[model samples]
Target: MEWLARVMGARRAIEVGTFTGYSALCLARGLGPQGRLLCLDINEDWTHVARTYWRKAGVADRIALRLGPAATTLATLPQEPGFDLGFIDADKENGRLYYEEVLARLRPGGVLILDNVLWGGKVVERRQHPGDTSLQAICELNDFAAADERVQPAFLPLGDGLLLLRKR
Candidate 1:
């Protein structure tokens, strides 16, 4: 994750799910001194843990954590396209909506990273619980991204699966 951000020279980043802030720390390490990271999550306990680590990592100043529904926070952001990179790992049912919002905010050369697209390989299975809305949403998002020409999309078989979308 840090490598991708560094290689892309990302100065601004947004992360939708910050469970303990591990990924946020990784992404923050790539930011320039003046860069910023906006982290959104609904779990206060989890973000508390993240705050501790962010301070320990000396990146607390660069990170701004918003505790609430990610969609609500994203909606409040200016629509004039501001981010250079974004990562979405929140509720699967709203994955496409999150993607649309993030993509619209991303600069022309920015990137959006979507996690759990493979759902631990269950995505290719014949049977799945209707309650597994995240998996269904991820599958739909993958298909949608692949068909969309505004971005170059690819699914990487990493932990679970990661969908990389780079805006054209």
Candidate 2:
């Protein structure tokens, strides 16, 4: 994430699922002093952990935590045309919607990172449990992203497959 943030020269970033704020902090470190990060998550307990770490990392001032449905929070923000970077690691069923929202707000050269896209190899299975909506959504999202000409997409096999989408 540090490398990703640096590569993009990210000034403002949005993280869809901030589990303990590790990734958020990682990205925050790469941001310039003036840069800010908006972290959206429904878990206040997890966000509490993130808050502690952010303060310890001395980046608390640069990070804001929004506790609610990520989609709703994202929709409420003023349409800026684009953000510097966006990381999606939330509910799989909302992958497409999240992608659309984030992409609509991504700068021309900004990046959108989607985690667990490989679904721990479950995506290759011909048969899957009906309850595995997250995996199913991921599969659909992967196909959609691959065919999207607006962004350059690459699926990397790193920690359960990370889909890197760069807005064109």
Name the top lDDT candidate: 1
- What TM-score does candidate 2 get on C-alpha atoms? 0.95
For model 1 the TM-score comes to 0.96
Candidate 1, which segments miss by more than 4 Å at Cα?
A: 126-130
Whole-model alpha-carbon lDDT for candidate 1: 0.90
Q: Any residue pairs clashing in model 1, and if so which? A: none
In the range 62-138, model 2's lDDT, one tens digit per residue, is: 99899999999989987776479999999989989899998898889899999998888998982665678777888
Instruction: Mark the regions of model 2 whose C-alpha exceeds 4 Å error after superposition.
Output: none
Worst 10 residues of 1 by lDDT: 126-135
lDDT of model number 2:
0.89
